[model samples]
Target chain A: MHILVVEDEPKVAQAIKNGLLSEGYRVTTVHTGEEGFFQAASQKVDLILLDLMLPGKSGIEILNALRELGKDTPVLILTAKDTIEDRVLGLDSGADDYLVKPFAFPELLARIRALTRRGRSDQVLKLKLADLELDCITRKVKRNGYDIPLTSKEYELLEYLMRHQGHAVSREMLAHDVWQVKDRATPLDNVIDVHINRLRSKIDTNFDQPLLHTIRGIGFIMKTEDEP
Target chain B: MKLVLSFRTQLMLLNTLLVILIYAVAAFFIYAFMKNRIESVELEKLQEQVSTVSTVVYKSGGDYNDWYHLGDQKPFLIMEDWKVSYQTTAWKDLNFPDKLTPGDFNNKSLKTYSAEQHNYLVKINFVRTGIDTMHNFQVVVAMENTEALESVEKLARSLVLGIPLILILAVAGSFFLSNHAMGPVKLLRIKAQQISAQSLSLRLPVINARDDIGQLTIVFNDLLTRLEYTFEQLKRFTADASHEFRTPLTSIRSTGQVALKNAGNVNDFKDAVASMLEDTDRLANLIHDLLQLTRHDAGRLKIDFSKEDLVSHINSVIEELKILAEEKGITISFLHPDTIRLHINPAYFKQAIRNILHNAIKYTPGSGLIEIQLRQEESGIIRIDIKDNGPGIPPDLREKVFERFFRIDNARSASVGGSGLGLAIAKQGIEINNGNIKFVDSNRGATCRMVFPANSAQDDSSAI
Candidate 1:
């Protein structure tokens, strides 16, 4: 996946760039609204991470200008201004998603994945890792060709983890992305742990190779046992 | 403290005093004129009585005893050659002055005399019956004036009594008039008193827009509107500032927590610490900028200004920001007269120039040209234009750029290391030195122009 990050802060841009690069995605970053606009207009990318505050032109203006030019690329707004009005304006101005600044990298990556997946309807909507398979259309999970019954939240958690396989996902990431909880300080770590344990017992206990692994203190990661 | 009367009370008292003065003057004139008329009419009647008495005595051929036929009740005394020749029956018991003589009587004379607690009008007539015979007789007739005097006294009494009554009525009338006139003002006072910070939208009732009180209320409502607008702006500014402050702090906290929880090696720890340090630095910068803004708003910040070459100052700022420009591969060029002198605080001037230049360098793409041009106009105003070959600001947002905490591009500005106070601070700094700064019309790029008077008399020591 190719992603364009239109951000002005050098440190933040670098951090996001590093995070996205480590996620195995090709990333292009621009520091100004005008440059961001030019790149978005002329370049082909799967998704664009737009910052509202920029030099040369504002993020909304760029979004509007791009939409006016008939560019249907998915856009995710990342900004420090998290007011309700700001969010409404960003969404109303053709942004596909809105994320406030100081966001978790995992949550950002999750949102990016979601936005990127929205445009590719022709591709198969299934997730697979070794013997584990999940069909998005049927909302079913299978391991070694055997059906695995899962709750909606467990399925969502599994899907998110599988989408970001081989990477450490924090409890905050799970709470924010899967549960859609905006406030990260809430005590949901035990709930997430309970659910993850339940999912591991149901999916990995009866299997030869474990696909879900705990990163101890950090979060959880889903991968084949032989992989890292 | 001096005593201050309320507007309503003052109006009432003034109106009452004016009414009393007018009524008193009118009463005085009426009383005087009535008294004069009464006295003249009484004297005229007394003179007619004396003339009748004199004709009767003269026709009687100076027969003293015949004067009794004129009127028995009327007091008359005829004195001839200093001797009482005839006296009425009523004058018999009356004591007459022994010095009564014809010399005391002119052709006809009328005078008032009080006798036995009764007012009398005395008329005396002197008659000489033969010119050669020299017979002179003084006939005196006295008539009681008690009725006319009683009527005049009654009128005087009524006047004395009516004046206070009229004044009392006048007082009541004036009070009512003043109260009615000030009714709208009273309503305005009550309504204005109810307006607090929370109820800024409430307006004083304007009953009559053409009246003075109504006009005053309209003006007050306009002032309230302005105040409310300012309050809203202040609230928004505070909210935005708090949000801006919270974002970086949240980043630092979250980054630290995640780093501590997830770090499994030295490299991970180093990377986490580096990110946390970056967020912390951003937080520190935000706080510093907020503090500076607060100080400036409170007028607590002092500026030290001296006469210096403005061209060199701009060059120094440009040189300082050269590394930042070089990082983006943007070229900055300066064009100015040889030595353009201006009176300014070097620090504040440099800060202002640095902000504009930084914005230019940050916005312009790599290999884009940034130009700084300084020229002295014929009007003795020094102008500096900072133009950038970047996406210029929209026309509608040109003026809003100076607003506190206002960012055109929220997302890009966040990453650009701007707290949204750079232009606001720069505008304030330039204004403090008696200069003007604004975004001028440019065809292709953003042009920010700062104009300063060649000889600014405003010094840094003075409060702005």
Candidate 2:
């Protein structure tokens, strides 16, 4: 996949380009709105990470110009303006997704995956990692022929963790996705921590090979021993 | 030219005009009355003289000289058979009328006649001679009234002459009175101009508290007091915000520097990076909370209120925080009879309840009890009480705990890990939803009491 990053600040543009490249995607970075508009209009890119604030011509003008020409590339807006009106304007101007600044890298990656994967996601009833097995239809979990009892909250947390098996999921993503909290300032870190601790003890306590592991300062990840 | 008059000048001019109008009408009436009195007195004397002359002429048997010897100084004329039969010597030089009409003699009428540039009072009478009605003659008596008219003119002259003096005095008096009345206003204006934002504590002097100007000054001083209070609050908020923001940044900076300096093993370096990242998360949360508060202060939040079941809302909040409470072995008991509907913004209301519940769980010890009671008061006010078996807040510090960045024990709160804006946000959220929250006295621990009106429309927080 090919991606284009249009950001004015050199350091932020370079950082995004490096991060996208490390994930095995061809990355192109542009520093001005004039050049960004040219590249987006002509270049063959699958997804575009466009910043709203830029020098010379603004990001909105570029987005408008490109959209007026019927370029159907999926545009993800990265902006510092998070007011309701700003979000509506970006979406109304044909932005596929909106992410606020100072965002977590894991959340960004998750959004990227959701956007690029679009209609290709297929439903699977059973998920497994090493001896652990979860049945999506029955809402049941088993490891090495032993059934595990989990609370409703524990079940939901484990399911989300298992869906993003190898990627580390930040607390903000869990708070928003699982708890459905729209306000980012809510102090739900402790609650998430407690639920994760319980889920960990239940799933990995009786087995020699632990599938769920903490990524220290980041968050939780579910993977077998040899994955990383 | 369009003339704009000062208030005091307008008052003076109006007063002076009123005085002049009243004085001119009074002088005109008094002059008319005096002139009339002088003319009436002259006419009465003329009639009496005419009677005396007729008697004299009759007694003397038609001898005009005998009546003339009575020494009447005024002019006289007699007409008989429609001809001037006799005339006084003075009457000839006075240019008296040639004839006295017989019609006027029938009633012995008196009339004013003007001849030779002088006004006269003329009295005509018909008298019988020697008791014979056939021998009757008409007597006409005339008096020169130019001197009397002149005296009245003199009186009018004096009256007219007094006007300018009276007008001068009226204008001066009005100006003096208006200047005296407006003296305090001038002083007030000068004092008010001297006060600025830096001197908001300065008060305008109240000359008389019961008067209009004094009342206005008092109201203005009250406005200044409120402005000063708001200014102080803003200053403190700025200082506290900067301090809160600095602490996390300081930790992040120091941790990053120390990690780079050590250059230790891979795992050790990873631990340092993780510590720094933790501080970064703290900073980010603080910034987000600050933005929310500022947005609320700017009145930018779009709040839509609707009727919802209060019991179910609280149940959901409790359910969300149940795991955290259970992890510490704390038991939460909700005591409510049935569903109670209320008008509120569900999002803000739920956040407030969640914050308060989280606080209870954080403060209570292991195996402690937390009770939430929901009921309607007798006055139709819906009340909710959240009480926990933790250390109770003191009476003096109850209100202070809701202030931003206020923690009972800073060291312990730091260790417990919160941005210190939870309670502040909770209070604001409740207030914006038209409810009141306060820490009431409890025997075992802190009891938070929140009350909402039975029915209220969307309320603006700025009003409170």
Candidate 3:
């Protein structure tokens, strides 16, 4: 999947691009309105991650300009403002979705996947890593075609990690991605960690090779078993 | 002055004192004048008797005239002009301390003569002897005394004694009258006590007569009418607050339920999750804004301000919101003067400025213009103006746009949720700091301007 990120701040733009690149999405970054507009109009992108404030042209003008030219590629607004007025104008001006800045990376990946999954129907219901297969509609998971029981929180956590397979996912990222509430602290009882531990036991304990890898000091990552 | 302990008691005492003063003075003069008149009448009668006897005595020359005491015959002498010249008259028969001598009696201012050993007041006058008025020696006599004089003294004493007794009666009468006069005041006090913030529906009682108390009752009832209106407005505000709070909660819950129901596949689930995330951010913004508005309303807008780099705070906020502006193709540039450090409550001030910027960013079209400038002018005013190229406010509503729950008809929506407390909170925050916020003169789009007292570091003088 291809995505265009237009942000005025270089550091945030770099972070988002780097984050999305490792998630297997082709990310193109720009810092100015002229460049963002050039990229949005000229580049064949699956999604556009745009900012509202830019140099040559404001984000709203670029968005409306793109719509004026009838480009239907999905554009996701990444803003640091969460005002109602901002959201309305963003969506009303032809943005497919609006996402504020400093957002969780996993949420960005999810939005990218959802926005780019236009013609791929069969890819919607199935998820696989190593011999583990999750039948999303049926709410069931199978390892080596054998059923595994998982709690609701454990399953949601597993799905978030698998969706960002082979990449580091932080506990904070998981809380935001799974819970979707900002600054919402799910109590310090090791809730997310406990669920991850349970899922690790289910997906790796009986197998000859463990697929869920714990990245020390970073977070956890899931990969095909036997990679190391 | 004693406190009177009771208002009515004091009034009663004062009224009785006035009445007793008048009664004593009147009784004193009446008794005195009557006693004097009765004594004069007795003297005149004695003088007549003396003249009659002297006429007889003068015809026989050098004869003395005398009379007996009324109802008791006793020796007495009547000399010239009713003057008593007695050896012992019935009036003077009782023990008297002194007596009258016969010669040069006119030289004495008064004489006491013993008549039956009683004291009598006498005066001597010579009658005419054949044309020599001065040499006449014919005598007529009478005793000068009356029970009326003594009785008048007794009567005055008896009436004067009744002064205190009348005063007591007047005091009791005044007490009842004063208590009756104050009856309505006590009633009003009781009524006032009963009517509190909660029971504003209660009213002061009004009596039938159109008197002073009636006028006061009318005034109090008008006051109650105003209080009830205020209470109703308070109730409406509470209801509006609850309704505003419930909306964001509803949005969040519905979003969560929608996402959870459709977690069928990766793409479907991802779309649901994204939508839920959007809803979540909205909910958080609402709660944060609500708390900020409440704090501002409580007069603590400056409670959170701290000394910080004003330029950096503006830059950081702009950088944070950079992506949002990018999406809308809007330009948010900061032109803050160099190292303009200010003592500000970061959270509250940011919230205030953020809300205004949000309005500008939201209403302006993609690629629309927005400019944020913070600089100090010569008069120690730090001005912050946020301007945007959006559909500006209608002229009529520009004044009322800062009212809570108010929405500029062209600028608000339920979709991109707002509690309509953003500008209201901003206005409140600025007002608390003795600063001001206003709509700058503009032909198109909205321009919000804020003026703060310059920080000490930025001001040329030490007055901030």
Best by lDDT: 2
- What is each model's TM-score for chain A? 0.78, 0.95, 0.76
Which candidate comes out best when scored by TM-score?
2
- CAPRI tier for the interface of model 3: incorrect
| Model 1 Cα lDDT, one tens digit per residue, B1-464 | 99899776788778878877887788788878888998889878778878888787677666656666787777877878767887777766455555675456543476667767787777777777643355678878777879888887887788788778877887788779888988887787788899998988788887888888778888988999999999988989989988988887898788789988886798787777767755654564566566566666887555766877988989977755675676578898999999877778776777788788877887898899999999998877889999999999998999889888888888787666667878887887788778999998998789999999755733434433
**CAPRI verdict on model 1?**
incorrect
Candidate 1 Cα errors over 4 Å, as ranges: A1-228, B1-10, B47-75, B88-111, B115-117, B123-130, B133-139, B301-304, B453-464
In candidate 3 the C-alpha lDDT for residue B210 amounts to 89
**True A-B contacts kept by model 3:** 0.00
Ranking the candidates on DockQ from highest down gives 2, 3, 1
lDDT, residue B166, model 2: 88
Highest DockQ, which number? 2
| TM-score of every model versus the real structure | 0.60, 0.86, 0.45
Instruction: Quote the RMSD, in angstroms, for model 3.
Output: 22.2
lDDT for A76 in candidate 3 is: 88
CAPRI-style grade of the A/B interface in model 2? medium
For residues B254-304, write the lDDT of model 3, one tens digit per residue. 766877776676666666555655555555555655655665456532253
RMSD of 2: 4.3
- Residue B327, candidate 1: C-alpha displacement in angstroms: 3.2
